[model samples]
Target chain A: MVLEATLRGIRLVGDRTLRIVERIGATVAFLVMTLVHSATSFRRFDLVIREIFFAGVQSLIIILVSGLFVGMVLGLQGHETLQNYGSEQSVGVLVALSLVRELGPVVAALLFASRAGSAITAEIGLMKATEQLSAMEMMAINPIARVVAPRFWGGVISMPLLAMLFSAMGIIGGFLVAVVLIGVDDGAFWSQMQAAVDFRHDIVNGIIKSLVFGVAVSAIATFEGYEAPPTAEGVSGATTRTVVSSSLAILALDLVLTAFMLKGWN
Target chain B: MERSTLNLWVGVFVLLGFFAFLVLAFKVGNLSAGGNGTTYTLIAHFDNIGQLKERAPVRSAGVLVGRVKSVRFDPVHYNAEVQMAIDTKFPFPKDTSASVLTSGILGEQYIGLDAGGDEKMLKDGDEIKLVQGAVVLERLIGQFLFNKAQDSGADKGAQK
Candidate 1:
């Protein structure tokens, strides 16, 4: 009996693994179909506007506040180190480079994923649960164009805007800390920062990364939502998956983009 | 519904804020270009380029007038060759010395120029002859620890 139970436990685990694979595959297929359909029926200007409003505009506060604090922390840390070496002017360079290249995009993407990803998943899941998606199909309306397109486009546009904001705010935060709190001269800090960063390359690279992140977040959330089963349990599962997948995608893309950008194609 | 609308407004405000910030950064930060000034080009040879990167600033008398453009390792000498661009206005004599200096304790490295008084100024593409290379941090830290160990050893011997 004990032996039989052990075998049963192994079979259950195998079945669970297969189930997860099946769900993931279904989501991928649905995402591809959504993308294709949206591309074919690309006449929806209103959808794009709505997307920009929702995805880009909604998450600005958190990005700014977080960016500000991050800058402050960097300044504080950099000041201590620079003070040790009597090179306090270099604090600006340290803070600026850190914000422009790494912190800005990564932090913004994570924040956006949390805000927009959850909403997209919950909205799609509810639509599926309430048969709204099916009703739209019966009415000869393409749900992908009507629903998914707006969110996707919004995410794509908003991410870059948010990233730019984050980087800017972070610089200001650093400036405040370096000049006011740390007692460094304002002119020196600004000059050091100017010397350190390549504004054109750094800003453009950050925006490009943000756009990619936006796409990943929207695509993952929309996939999870559209594929959610009709039950309440399905909605929760979709929400969880959307968050996890988008966060993972953001981190992975960050690594890839960092490597590519640092490789000096510019 | 209402939450979505709220989100939309917030995003717009953030975008506006970002644009304003960019304008402010460029303005207040003084990231602008002016007429070409006096500058000099210096080449440094190194066995290892280490963490030196392109666009790293070059400073003379605590003023930045140029930057390092590229780093290439010469196969003939098996040494890293660093090319620096200086403003045209800052005159550097032929006898001037160039050294790689760290910004902070663990901060990025830059090329520091010490102005020399030669009768002639270094023209475009002229290389500074006396380069002091980089002061590697690991070696400095190691020396500190070794000296401390030696001092402790002497103290113990005296006590015995």
Candidate 2:
């Protein structure tokens, strides 16, 4: 009996592994389908605009407030560490580069995943659970084009802009804390930052990173929702999966992108 | 939400994003003062470039006038060949000397251009004749140590 139980356990693990691989393959196909359908929304335009309002504008407050706090914390901590080395002057460069190169895109994307990503998943999941998607299909409407593609493109449009704004606000916050409160020289702060931060390498890479994250998060959200079983519990589970998988995807993609972009420096 | 209101909000959001982008580019990241407009390339060869790198500032009289465009090994001459993009506005005479320099003890290496009294301005692809290579701190320290050891030896001979 013990031997039989061990074999059962091995089978269970193997089943789950295959299930996960299946899900990943489905998600990639869904991504391609979404992209092909996206061209339809361009003619409509309003469909995409409405999604931009929901995904981009609605999430603005949380992104801005979090950006400010993160920057303030960076300034305070950077000051504490850099002063010991008598290089407090570089606090500006430190704060700016960190925010631009890594923090801005990463933190903003994580927040977007939890905020807008989960929302997209839940909204579509509920539509599926309530048979709204099936009704659209019956009405001769292509739900993928009419509903899903606009949301996908909306996220792609908004994520990079949001990340840029977050970095900008973070810089301002850093300036206020480091120069105004901590008494570091203002000129040194700005000048050193200007000298060190290259626009092409740091800022452009940040934009590209956010754009990629937007695509991943939106694709996962929409795919999970579209594939969700027509039940309340299924919808909820898919929503949870959207958050978990997209967060993991964002981090993994970031590592790959950073390694690829860093090759140009030398 | 009202139809006009939604459009207005998205418009504002897009505008704000581009505005933030401008701030990052111009105020924070040196976009305004970045290399643009017309520039002329000048070549200089050195024995040892030390840590001088591409995009290192080319300064004349402590003012940034250009940037290092490229650095390569000159196999024929057995040295380093550096190409610099000098701004067209601040033209240098053909006889100008270029030297590799450092800032603040151990800071980054850059090119220091000292102008000459020649009437002709440097043209694009012109070669700078006088070039000073980077100063290697290890070599300076080694020379100082050798001089001290030699002096001590001479003092020992005198005592004997």
Give the best candidate by DockQ: 2
Could you tell me every candidate's TM-score relative to the true structure? 0.72, 0.93
Best by TM-score: 2
> lDDT of each prediction vs. the true structure?
0.78, 0.92
Task: Write one digit per residue (lDDT tens) for candidate 1, span B72-102.
Answer: 9899998789998887767788898888888
Model 2 per-residue lDDT at B97: 99
Candidate 2 residue spans exceeding 4 A from truth: A1-21
Where model 1 places Cα greater than 4 Å from the true spot, the runs are: A1-35, A39-42, A72-94, A174-178, A181-184, A260-266, B1-52, B85-108, B112-160
Judged by whole-model lDDT over C-alpha atoms, candidate 1 comes out at 0.78
DockQ of 1: 0.20
Give the distance in Å from residue B6's predicted Cα in candidate 1 to where it truly belongs: 10
State the lDDT of candidate 2 residue by residue for A1-266, as single tens digits. 99999999999999999998898899999999998888888999998999999999888888888888889899999999999988999999999999999999999999999999999999998998898999999999989998899999999899999999999999999999999999999999999898778788889899999999999999999999999887888989998999999999999999999999986645
